[model samples]
Target: MVGIWGFIPHHRVLEEDTILQQQQEFEHSIHKSGSESDVVESIDENTEKNDKEILISKRISSDNEKEHENENNLEVEIQDFDVDYDYVPYKFGEKTYKIREIRDEANRPWWKVFDEFEYRNTKSEAKSYKWYKWFPEGTSSAEKKLLVKLDIFLAFYSFVGYWVKYVDSANLNNAYVSGMKENLGMKGNDLINTQTVFTVGQIVFEIPWIFLLPRIPITYGLTIAELFWAAFTIGTYRVKTVSALQAIRFFVGASEAAYFPCIHFLLGSWYLPHEVGRRGALFYIGQFLGVLTSGLLQSATFKNLSGNGGLEGWRWMFIVDGGISFGVALLAFICIPGTPAKCYSLFLTDDEIRLARRRMKKNGTDVNQSTKALFDLPTWKKAFSTWHVYFLGFINILGFNSNNTSSGSFVLWLKSLKKYDTVMINNLSTVPPALGILYVLIICVGADITRKRFLFVSLSFLLNFIGNTILAVWDVSYGAKWFAFCFGYWSWSQSSVFNPLISDFFRKDTDVRAVAWMAIYIIGLQSSAWIGRLIWPTTASPRFHVGFSTCAAFSIGFAVFIGIAYFFYKNDERRESLENGIYLYNSETGDIPQFVLDHPEFVEKNRYD
Candidate 1:
């Protein structure tokens, strides 16, 4: 039991500061650092086609005086972090951004001699915050070129991949309400049971991928996962009983379990902290559209294709959804840009690859983790030892449960009325997720513009709690209930903010980041499996008193826990700054290398900082 619970320590939790001094300090610093933090963008997408539109990288000069004298390389003048010339802001006309250059030659095997990253400096942000400038401020031409390719290949892939998967998931809900329950003779709690089985399968299968990813090639891992999801999704069309539906759902869930967190890690591996926000937002857009598309698809199919091939509309939905999933899987084979260090994309150049690595290093992102460390007992120990794992994992559970409305509660309510056709019901069910797009945009855009991540996140949860509270009242007016349903959907999507926030928080340890990402869905989903079966059985849907009450409590938990986590994160950053004069990014992760996955180096690895 001690071994099992070792990750949780008494010191991990923070007392709500009566004075809230830590909160004050963090908010103050974020304005300065976060403005320039994860928000940088790629240079002009069109102008850099020939790569001539770049700020040329000069060769490292043997004489510091001569390098500074060069006219093309503007002499940088900044007030922070630059001691011994290592942390210097670079000049671009009248505007300059904090740029740090670090050189460690002992183990530097790459072509670039020094790693130069653009530091998130608020000093320049005051002047640089333009309402209209599209590119990241003070970006190098080479860096811009890389961001364009990454946006094209990886960002779009992130959007499309989640879009197809969610479309299928929402299809499951639509099918269940449309005709599958009647066809399969699904009785009390059967809908919840099917969902529970999928959660169980996901939890069971997620463990291996969490451990195996860094130890295997990216292609092999993606192929296995996609094959499973595609086959099981297609198989669902043939299920004759609830048991068969549950069985297929389980395998489909298990196969695709690693996707959400893995993509998050992939994004964090390649992009800066500021870039992550909008990219993460784009990723969630796919999900919203997926849910929305599922409804529209069901409506059209029921009207057009039902009974055409001795198949119900729900069955047809599965066949079409599965085909889409398979097609997206093929796209993944080509477009999945492996980690920045080991990127094997056909769109990137050698210089752009190096630029990607430096950008990550600027914000202390670890882009060079060794696969050889996978087996080290200390590596596993470092991953588990941090408060980050427990704090972040549990916070995600609370966040997800807070948002989970079982059996598509809105759909269930519409179904209960017995007044709407399949077409109207499907269309009505989409309102919450559709409005959610705007809600998410408001929150994410606020966080990006103000550089206050925790502020928006806490506000998101507070509103989530309010929405669930209204639903629990259940005796309210009809229009009010509709308002509650729509209100909840608008506030419920915080995973986008949380994804990059968690990535930025746990940036140092790659294993811990991966594990925390895994915990978000793995452990969170496991708890959900039990909750769905017992507390939220469809028999009680549309007015699940216990479930709604539970959601309300967890929503508050989400707020409290996130606040506590933020306090500690800032506290750590504060202490490190005080001790070292400035926070030093000890991050070391690399792009995916060929041999790291197949035959890891057995070199003795350093313990996690």
Candidate 2:
């Protein structure tokens, strides 16, 4: 028989003499007959004696076998460790297996196995951390330096790209309410039509982006997308008709669609599981900051630059914002690192690149790729069939809906007040986005610390429920409504953590991860745009009771979906443990399971420490 660890199973065969002795004892007992009770007693005593003797002999034999096996294993282990080779022998059950060419030892939680290899020459001391526990563990000095460099070069550009994408998309709304509606003779529903068509464009291009992203380098893809969107944003400055503005918006949306998911996918490729959430949060925060900055920029332009240089304030907003985006696109082309394995950034050294690749490999991430795999039908089928994609997509729809209540309608509410001018309306709109930035940072940091992403996601939904309830049911005062609007933005924090959640769940499969990540936004944004058009119709005005009520209900549903996802995830983990003959525990103090010690890819997913 083959053992579980893929080695020949050891078997002990009984000697012929031992078998004959047992048969003779049984025959003797059967033949002994005296008085009935006496015979029975005699047979019982002989039977007991035979059984005891057999047990004693078996115990002795087992001890001898174990002792011999241990001696052999020890010798093998010593020999394997003494050699400077890629493969190491590991003993499990009655078998020994060879582990080959480990790329990274430090990132694996079971690194102690390698450390204990007696003849290993490398420095294998446990890394010490001076920072908080939330920070990524087992990071070497080289990795720390690399992380700083990646943050400065890669993360910064991702943030900027995301920021500009949002600024360009959001400028339309700011422009519409400020003066674009009047300038282009856009009546009721024209503004909403623009949003709907933009979302349509986004949906149309989502799958194409997903297909192409893996084949092309992310930096080049993102830079090209950014430049295209910037040109469209600049084109918005020349729109003299509603049809022209709609055309410009649609193309802009299509170009900007790649930025979010692509950036997220890039981050997942570069960072460890523990390191991704905070960076993702920072990347997401850029969107809110962009929204906030957009309002401020519009206010400034309206106050100072309106009708100056032969352009209206709204037109000037696009021209200036597009110019800024063009500049960022240029910078991104120069600065953005494609991936840690194939990084072209001036900031990273060859050693750092190797270290980064090693870390990702240990995490079981696919660091290498081929263009042919991009169109693999089986890959897409598996990715689409998983519950992770559909459930997360549904949850994201709710999240998008909840956030839109703040971003879409809150400024409109300010406009409806009539007491505030365009400047005040633009300036006041910044409040929710600013608060959203802080909320996102706090939640994301907490998620990283606790490693409870779904928990935070639930809390965000609950906050949305509360915020929406106030907006839907309460009409006591403007102060209460404004507070509700600001509170509603807190749900935007969910976006920050969602990427990390997806990254962790799909960490083992690159194609699935890429497809699922993009699909979530595609489904969520399209659903929100369509559903939002119905609930927040032109008739609803400032107090869209129907929209708020629907959002509050979805918030509850979102929480329920999160709970369901958690249940399934736990069940899946347990099933994996059972199939592998490994016991699952909530702590990390017991014997390291052979499965984990052998498979570096499962270390992070299985580690409870």
What TM-score goes with each of the models?
Answer: 0.75, 0.75
Cα RMSD of predicted structure 2: 18.6
> Which residue runs of candidate 2 sit more than 4 Å off their true CA positions?
1-138, 371-373, 405-407, 577-609
Per residue, candidate 1 scores C-alpha lDDT tens digits across 1-609 of: 112334221111112221233333334444435542221222244444334212211112222333233312322231121232333443435855333322111343452211111123322333454434545566555556677888888889888988888887888789988888899999988888888888888889878766765545564467568867887888899999988888889898888776876788788888765567677777888888788889999998888989979999889888888888888888787777677645555556544554565566655566654344444455566767878767887887776677654457889888889999889999888888888788877777666655567778888888878877888888899888888787675445677777888777767656666666665556676777776566677888778877777777888898898888876776666443312223222325544433223322211123111
What lDDT score belongs to each candidate, Candidate 1 first?
0.66, 0.69
Per-residue accuracy of model 2 over 362-469 as CA lDDT, tens digit each: 555666443334576766787888788788888888777865543368878878778989988888888988998888887787676555677777888898888888
Those runs of model 1 whose alpha carbons end farther than 4 Å from true positions after fitting are 1-85, 88-134, 490-492, 578-609
Error of 1 at 82 (Å): 12
lDDT value, candidate 1, whole model = 0.66
* Number of the predicted model whose lDDT against the real structure is largest: 2
Q: TM-score of the candidate numbered 2?
A: 0.75
Residue 127 lDDT (model 2): 32
